[model samples]
Target chain A: MTSASPLSRLPPGPLLVLGYGNPGRLDDGLGPAFCEALRLRLGGDAHRAGPHRMTIRDAFQLNVEDAAEVADHDCVVFVDATLPGPGTFSFEPVTPSTRRAEFTTHSATPAGIMGLARDLLGADTQGYALGIRGGEFGGFGERLSPVARCHLALALDHFTALLPRQEGRPTVCATPIRGEGVHHD
Target chain B: MNPVLQTDTERIVIEPVTRVEGHGKVTIHRDAEGRVAQARLHIVEFRGFERFIQGRPYWEMPVAVQRLCGICPVSHHLCAAKAVDLLVGGESLTPTAEKIRRLMHYGQFFQSHALHFFHLASPDLLFGFDADPVDRNVLGVAAAHPELARQGILMRKWGQEIIQATAGKKVHGTGAIPGGVNRSLTREERDTLRAPVSHMLTWAREALELARGYTLENLPDVGHFGDFESNYLALVRADGAMDIYDGELRAIDPRGEILLQEPDSQRYLDVIAEEVRPWSYMKFPYLKPLGPEEGWYRVGPLARVNACDFIDTPEAEEARQEFKGLAGGGPVHHTMAYHWARMIELLHCAEVIQRLLDDDDLLGAELRTEGPRRRREGVGILEAPRGTLFHHYRVGDDDLVTRCNLIVSTTSNNEGMNRSVTQVAKQRMEGVDRITEGMMNEVEVAIRAYDPCLSCATHALGQMPLIVELVDEGGDVLDRRARSGGS
Candidate 1:
């Protein structure tokens, strides 16, 4: 494991996993699907009640109010589906964006929320964006695409291995499986 | 960004208007003499949700329709629930169910208005329209007026909490069921929400003052910004009091003459008609009697304030009086007054929420009601954050929805928004040597006044960036400039 990267050393404080996208739209449900998989993998209440102090939330899209919830946490992982890219998934750290020149209440970016938390709410919360590659986003349906489902499984496996294992759960990896870092913008 | 022209007659297209909800583009055509000839707001995206929900079971409507919008899903949720109430013979809900629904609706209004004013519209009002783009957003508001920005965040948070308490969750809540809500507000939830009422009301009042002061202080410029006389429509109580959750339809002309007033929600089709234009995906809804050309009217905050006889709440009623005085006893046709009117409604929602929280019915055991007979067809109408929203459905004997038609707030204001763009285009773009960022924003400001939610109107989803293209008279592209992200 490379200690030079922030992802190598997880924050000891409270961590929030926020999965936001329109679940009604096909493939867009990858974020919530990841959260669901993480929850089930961690067992009932293990993610939240465990020693890691992690919280999971699902939303249609990030908005202005999310900053408040994000501010209370030491770190937040914003998960969403992305168009076809170089890999199955990309996980990268995010910083407060100084170039966000406009505001839309309907949707907000992870960096934008972090910026709001730091600037308006006086918070120093760290943020990360996890984009799972998906094949379809053009229609409305509850189910994810077949390829997106495969990517989701791979993403869940890769992400859960990085988490602190539960008492009864299987062994986990201490380092990331891949080093491909992609920005969600 | 580069500005260059190649022809005397050309078209300027502002694709994906910023700051407002959904993806929309504006096209302004100039004549040979360089005068603005025509301006049209085109809704580029379309989601046939009305057809998408046709075969679904009637019971799934309240939950299914929430997918139409992410910003105001509660509005769609409650409106569809109201329509489904008729399908299941539950039009007359129990006191508890009605009050709970009212509380949820008010929470939507409060949070939606707060977000619009503080996050979307405040930058333009605080900094002049021509201010630098870098320092003209909520962050800039945070840097300059930290306290106001904080209040905006907290106020929106409190309203979302109210939704979480009444509804099952914040996003895609299934609290409002077919006959009634699935759950009641627990005493603990009520207490948690009640504790923040006074502060919200205080903040709402301060925000109102800011909007009011801005409008009055800039009357000359604000009044003439896309100013025009058009009919206003909204739902009002029987005594003509402003009622957002439930009431009868009322439309009034610019001269304050009552154009139409129908108490029966089911008979809405008899009085209103929608005209479909080939250029835009959205339909223009007009009063049936006046026909399409003359009947295109405005809806939403400005229209609601003008259509009602009086506001029920004390503070908002007082503010309404002052707002009405601006027109000297007629409808306030100034488009920029929408911000001021929106703040008045925000304060009113706060007061209404405070009153609703004090009622014991919210904690009551009874949450559902049923009528003597079922209905095959039903129409639900309510004043959403933007304006009056209509949801109509026809159910088959098999319990499946056979047909559905929804006239979202933005769709209703389609013609009005187009007119606003035309007015602003003429004022800002005509005879201009070069098109500046400020000029583009001035046109957008007029559309922002309506606070149009294009996502709900078109039932589509997509990100929008600001793209302005100058097209020659022969449809050739002369120049193009693009800006990433929304305002």
Candidate 2:
């Protein structure tokens, strides 16, 4: 993976990276932990536009109210911890989905939120879902498992490489890598 | 699709009921003659949160317990903070502290109820319960009723802004501490919240009218759907007004006779006890005097409205009167009335918030206070959006929590949900050769009425989908149908 700054090559518009899961549950904290790492790498100027602006947020789960926030951004990447898979991580574009797969007040999928943003708020924001493989999810603890930490590092490296280059080629992965980390429709 | 024919008695199971908070399932049993024998609601996962909190420092509880449920974390946070206030001998908080906490709580109620009504419940109402699974969802609602759907999203956002301002963040906020709040609302925060009050009020009123109109228009169906007579319980102010933040315990029978009144929060154990049944992970709570069988009662919006004498807010009070008139001065046993009652409370929260935003006390500097002596044990009881939530704790001399017990709102409504499922099963599934999707949804709709947060009740986690299975008496799988999405 390239050590160059990923933000420099991204689309020139506001970007929202939301990482959500229960930090109290072991390995479930992978999302927030990844956000913390990304924030540090971006430094204090992350919120300001270098080439493009970036905002990072963490929550216990995605909710219906998040639609408004998503609408305000030009692009959004939803990061979450997935059950152990063959690959370290999987990244895919998220389009509006009318399907209500397990939709509830407590949680909403990236596709569902994107759908709400488009349908209710008339937003044209591009969306992507990034799922990092996790091993431990049974107990209540703040620390991430060792294997999950390794996967997180690898996933971060792969994500940084997947960003668009300065030539302004396509910004994100169009085709989903079929893996356990990818959520099936 | 039709269920396969079987000779012996059969059991139909609906696993991971959709649209509600967490994971749970429903099972219906049929006798040899295809008569509805019995139905049960089973909580599938268990986290043992009470046991999880033990050995932790008492001061860590308010924030620690928020991990119980992502949906109602603020409810758990405030309720735990209230309990810890007693442990620290700070039960009487400064006016500013109390108001801030109340504001935070009202924000929780507003947002939670809005989400349930607009997203979870409205899909079933807007499109009939039997509507195709593909079109029965919030997205579908948005496509059909854009304006109403927009109002729902904005209403939810407004309430969430209130929570963010008061609680310090939207998720797992730590503003509430042992003695009092961490800070008071700043002038800027106050203005930001105040600007949207009128708009929120208007939307709230419109939503209430929608629920009221639906209930009245479909009275015959709504009234009879999962309808049954039982006891009602909630936390009511001393003067018998509806008070969700803090109050004494009140339980009224189906006839509106007070069975238990003005019981201290500390005496909750004396008034109610939980009975463990072998079939499910959730426990059934009942009035102590009546025993398990006869004492089981319902809680949440329906019960809160029935148990309280009147709502303090004028708009909610008028709505409550009309809601009560549905029964001609009697308690409303109609399960579908929960949606209407929830709207009333949502409007009341908006009014109360509008009033509180004007109070100088919210901007006051006095944030916390503590008494001279400390207490070893304490109990906190408040009406969460779902129902009355109880949090109790015992602290050791070292300031570590020795024990903890949480009776979440959903646990209180467990028996009621089971009864509703049974009623729907009997009404829609009896003598049917095949259980259609519509019949399955009828059972789910009954459980959805209570808005049970199975995650909060069991302290577990999972994404739920609708799965129905048919099994013979010998536990052999006869047929199975599964849906990718839930209710």
Candidate 3:
């Protein structure tokens, strides 16, 4: 690839992703771990993770504004594990500014957060946050259990059925913000 | 009968303006020969929040009151969380958690600020009321500045996502659970935030540059925030960062007098007293030490700028310099300058959010800690895009909330905005002959400069019509006003 290629122009720019939290806490650090898997799938070239043609961050960082920032872009597939929610898995588009309470964390409802982002970015952006249900929620579980790990470890072949008959990044997740919960200080 | 021009000596009144967050009115009278003599702005909402939350669960208080607004939820989330954090006995949260909270707030800033610029105030900046209703809105902005409109929306998403993932949701933010949060992030997700965060930083700078190049307000433009000299208020970390979280409640006058810097945000009533009038539902708040006559203040961008010494991030600093250069000082007190301040904050939010990603602790495992068993009553405060927001609640022994109080951004600056409107009217329209719809729109935009979300401000349901009116000396109406929205 030529040095002038768009893909080669990263690393020097501002950081696009930084997954924080303790991986030992089970679902806590599933963010970075998910990206690591995605990174590998992309052959370290974020674009290879399916046809969406994204870096690891470009692949995920799912916010309405993220779409606008990359004008020529299409979709974002975020991957993360949630602790002790419903058994198995669930998928839904996030809205803006709505907040939901977790056992240990006080977060805005994914709906409200993304909805607000949509309001800000308007027609320029659109994306989704994918959450992985985790077995280890309380205290410290130290590692992704079999179920959660399997979810993160799934290959591209598995993702094909999730979206549709598409090659490049398939546009997804268009929903309004809906959620409500109190955040304790 | 006197000539039409001579009727300026008659007394007139406008009960309430329409399509705004809170209640307010305009009174105009002719002194002698029929020109407008005296005009005043009155607030009508009272202090329901302080009176209701005397005994409530401190932890649940913030969220309970957060129902106050569909817009600017993060401000209440931060303020309430910080106040309760102060009430509860606990060490500071992990830096990672703090950054997460700040990052979410920045997201709030991006969305709220952008909303103010686009959805609420952009029409006046770009098109007058004369602009076709069908194409005057986002369409017009898209036509005029598509790139800016695009950036504004996307940046908001990044901020909201950071908060949403951390708290499980974004608005009515439930992320800052007492003792610590109830959730932890996955490493991969943290990495994902990097790209959007970085992209936002670049775009935010572009936003700042664009904002610097254009003045968001004109004395006679539609959807414009006019200039007004008033007291400014906001909270700031001792380090002078862009404080949306915890800090003493400080008030500064136009001359920069530190009127009050109470360590407790709940003590807002002591330092601040709200005034209600027959004309409007929105309350006017002024320093208790200084009566309404002496209490003219402002909030939002200009207020935050005046109240804070400097911004926390680098791009914000550059934007801050440009802001100073615009109004000829370290920061601005003019309400219109809020447009500039809002963009600067958007840039800061993007930059600070990225810097937060660099922290390895974000990728660490230790995030939440169980709280010691207890029930407490408290209030939280944060500067929403509009102004200060207070969420107070009372929970019983069983951990169920029994009472709630919401002192939203509109309430915090009700008194200030009322005074601000009168000042703006006097300065921008008093001596003018042609007071067309576009001119009146400028007056309305001044109130919108605070980006008041009446739904959240009053915790009131429905898109009720908020009214503002101008009255003459003979108790006759001169101009009755309501916003000409999407319709």
List TM-scores of chain B, every candidate: 0.97, 0.97, 0.81
- Top candidate on DockQ is 2
The per-model lDDT (C-alpha) reads 0.85, 0.84, 0.55
Off by over 4 Å in 3: A1-185, B1-34, B37-59, B86-88, B128-135, B216-225, B264-270, B326-331, B369-376, B392-405, B427-435, B464-484
TM-score of 1: 0.92
* lDDT (Cα, tens digit) per residue for candidate 3, span B294-394: 87566676677777778877768866766776556644656666667777776776666677677776665555444454435556677777776666655
Fnat of all models, as shown: 0.51, 0.69, 0.31
Per-residue lDDT for B1-487 in model 2, tens only?
A: 1133245679888877888888888888898667888888888888699997899998999999987887889989999999989987798999999999999999989999998999889989999999986778777788899888888999989888888888888878888998999989889899999998999999999999999999999998988899999999999999999999999899999999999885579889988899998777799999999999899999999999999999999999999999999988778999999999999999999999999999989999998888865579988899999999999999898888999999999999998999899999999988877888888888999999899888899966666557787776776777788875444
lDDT of 1: 0.85
lDDT of 1 at B125: 94
Residue B416 of model 3 has an lDDT of: 55
Say what the interface RMSD of candidate 2 is: 2.5
Q: lDDT winner between 2 and 3, please give it.
A: 2
TM-score, structure 2 vs. true: 0.90
Candidate 3 chain B has its poorest 10 consecutive residues by lDDT at: B459-468
Q: How many Å off is the CA of B479 in candidate 1?
A: 3.9
Model 1 misplacement above 4 A: A1-9, A44-48, A86-90, A101-106, A135-141, A145-151, A154-185, B1-8, B474-478
Q: Worst lDDT window (10 residues) for model 2 chain B?
A: B1-10
List the candidate numbers ranked by lDDT, top first.
1, 2, 3
Predicted structure with the largest lDDT when compared to the true one: 1
DockQ of 1: 0.44
